[model samples]
Target: MDRPRRCVLLKFGELALKGRNRPRFVNALERNLRRMTADLGPIEVRHRGGVFIVSGDMPQEELAERCLGLPGVSVVQPALRCERDATAAADAAVELLRELPGHTFAVRATRRDKRFALRSIELARLLGDAVRVRLGLDVDLSNPDLELFVEVDHKELLVSVERLRGAGGLPVGTSGRALVLLSGGLDSPVAAYRMMKRGLRCDFVHFSGRPFTSPESIYKAYALVGRLDRFQGDSRLYVVTFGPAQRRLATAGAGRLQVLSQRRLMVRVAAALGERLDAGALVTGDSLGQVASQTLPNLAVVEEAAQLPLLRPLIDRDKSEIVDAARALGTYDISILPDEDCCQLFTSKPASTRGHPDDLRRIERTADIEELVEQLAESAELFHPTLEERAMVSAATPASRGPSLG
Candidate 1:
């Protein structure tokens, strides 16, 4: 006889707290799940009460595994559906326990179908007796080696032995959007991930020093976004040519102020693009005092150029903490690859602490900030990696040995 097909059950965490906007967030989560799992095969996704049930030809375990990365999902269980009868529910619980390896077990059962004669406690006791008689396993409610979970809803009872933890947060796109200034470095990608965890769907804006510098940064940004795509589905990358703008800033001969001027221009350009994309904010990976351009007064001076909120997710984190998070997110290896960042080009001595707004104004006199931002926006190259491109990136070699620009 063929084994009964199983389905994965998903429960929402913070998303459940939403009052009137609950359906919107739930719909967003459903869309993301469908898009991420479309390649697995044909699947059926249904939401009942507060739980989502996914039934399809795809292996239930694999589906549960894939759902671990989805935000708004709190728990995943591979459950077998059975008729909502005490005997059938107990039999299904025994079948699940037979496959699981454990001598000490506990049955946590919930009876939602009021029409069923057995109460919650009665159903748990019945299931426990069945396990004890059929399999001879001792019950330890406090600390069990394995736990069999049963949920009786409407006309069916769902039974499972294993429950997996999910990535818990508000669904992406439930919050407003942001434009992330993604550099080919460890911090920016981590910043992007943090913002996504907060429910902000992010589009990337990368400034590369092509022609004047290697094309390594562009490829690195692509690889970085590819990893992030797993979380937010698809991402759009705006690559702006920054070499000409760097030269313009250097022409001012403001010495240490060149870095500050360059940052101001970058933020200005990012804000402009952010408005174009209708992003509510701009994100960066700036950590306090990590670099010469990130000083308190320097950050203040640079932020004056933008009209929108500049969100620095890593502002308070130390480099070590940021690196640890990067490694965990699987972007550390790619970010550590050799690449010439535009910010590192053409500058030797940068301001150690801060630069005065008076000195900045003096330097601003030499270059047309408006023209530079407009030029960057005009020459920007937009990249939206196809699903195939993302898959290729996932299977390809590490970025260090990966393909380079011709």
Candidate 2:
């Protein structure tokens, strides 16, 4: 075996403040991280001195790639995670700068263990002072050419400056579960992301158009959510074919009414899925009046069927703002993939901008909406994101599956 060119270190940040619930939270985080990086190498997760360390045959750069996006992680700087001598420490610091674009930099050390006779400030100054004399560098604290931070733990040491970008929230499965209405569009996935950032575990309810609609669009939406789960860790998605119902309503002279009717059915389906799956609410991308179907009056008609709380995380956000957030979280590229969602099935005249709930109920009675619901419920496919492959596939695929809600 080519000797494992891997790096070992601990992750700490917000978990420090967590009291009794700390172990439960870290266990969930460590599990998710291992799942995401499993294929790359045999990654190991351990708890030490109020932090979790992952070690194995994985490079610091590649391992850092997936570790940064994990929730509950605050700092991910490189570490030795083992005992070190002064020569080793000094050599590591010097070697770090040797491949630099410039030669002028300093090393700052902090000794928390106190086993080292040289005090923290004393050791830091000497490291900097020695580097200045040996490498002809300048010591600039406020605005240094570069900074080498050495954090010494009991038996190990970490040396590096490539800081990891954490998800900066509580771990997944911490807050309660919620069902996300994932569309291939930009807003819904962004909505799911914002909620996940707040520690809300999510199960996506995707309404796809099948038989009448091509499989590509549904695949595109699944792919989008999967990308996020790769960043997040474990997420489940339910793919329900609502096309026959949507088509039936359209053919029944309800083209103008199809959008609202389908939405009510979506809410109804989500409510049942939530009940079965322990999800607390239904989250959507329905921004107020963003489109004809999302208008204030139309929105009310769409939401009339739901007994559960409807979470519109992006309700007040402008499209531009949602798009910016999506791009930052790496969802924008997949959201624009080559496919169309069920929403593209109709282009009605005037498109019912101002809808009345009572009228919607009357239409539902006349249109036999229960039949639509029956067809939709029977066709639903429960899909969870595959964290191992780092990609989304149909639930039927042998992949890294999650809890089944059926």
Candidate 3:
């Protein structure tokens, strides 16, 4: 008997419904999968109808877990490649079941190749009887303690007992590129993840209260970006120190409109950076009425300052939903770390919820908004969080420079 080889069975969700554009989406997903797992070792991806079979040097379970984070993938099954016969599949199933603890089990077989002698039900029944007779396990169809899967393809048969859920959406870069206004907060990182799920290849921009404040928030933002980079590799974070700019806003007698004015400037600076990076729009974590600065009126006032379109993925979502997503995305811990965010500096105790466009424009004039935007853009520091060497391009002052990852 030949030894069973481990492999991953990958399936996509929405990409399958793409009709004429399905191949393009699948190709994009393939490229993304390879890039995401390049560190693991070389891998081969073979497309068979709707599912893809990936074989590589890395452990199958580890490879499946890594592929789960990739967008466009719906399900990942780590299985053993066996001979294309019922006896081989039942043998593989018994081998897999021995490692998994379950008294009751169900065999679910899918026969994609008609050339197979037995039907799908026949294969399932054979495996189900084998597990029942040989392993002393009962069969439960509705709610089983374990679900053993046997997939029959043209060339081979795969048997497994576990199915991992993937990050279901279109492939990253399929929906074009956008820049996320990533803050050291709960909402923005979640917002960036949401956009990435929608296939937007997103880079991040973080505004830090440097010079007037400590580098704690910059470190937090750096950590946050590093966490998010796992979903979409080669993540870039541009940090702009805005303490001086905020001080100017405060001295301009903006009063209750201080936070609103600061937010507008941040958007302007982000838009400036976005232009150079060719980002079509800017993404934010604004949940409607979540804070005074996020009120509808204030949000509109801030949106006017952005040269590119502003996308708020969490606008309609409540705080709880955003928090839950943050926890799941693995950024909640980093975001909750104490740090003085740039917008929090020079902010009034009670910010205006209904900030008028004219008043913000007037404040912009007093602060020389365009010139300030230009300066902030020029001083932006670029960091690639995924790279362990702490590779960065420093265009800002020494104080604005990020701390060593070590």
All candidates: TM-score: 0.91, 0.83, 0.92
lDDT value, residue 261 of candidate 3 = 89
- Global fold similarity of model 1 (TM-score): 0.91
Error of 1 at 312 (Å): 2.1
Model 2 scores worst on lDDT over the 10 consecutive residues at: 397-406
> Judged by TM-score, which candidate is best?
3
Q: For candidate 1, write residues 55-174 as lDDT tens digits.
A: 888778788888887888989888988777778777788888887777899889886677778888898899999999999999999999889898888857888988888878877888
Off by over 4 Å in 1: 1-4, 391-406
Q: Say which candidate scores most in lDDT.
A: 3
Model 2 per-residue lDDT tens digits across residues 1-406? 1121236454656767889988787777777677768778887765666566677776777777767777777777665543455555665666666666655566678775778767778767766766677677787777777788776656656566555657677777777788888887789988887787667888888887776676665665667767777655567778887777677667656667767877887898788777778888889999997888898888877777875788888999998999898888777876776555687675477678877777677767776877666656666786655644334434443232223333
lDDT of 3 by residue, 57-157 (tens): 99876898889888998998898998897888888999999877778999888888887999999889999999899899999999999999988888889
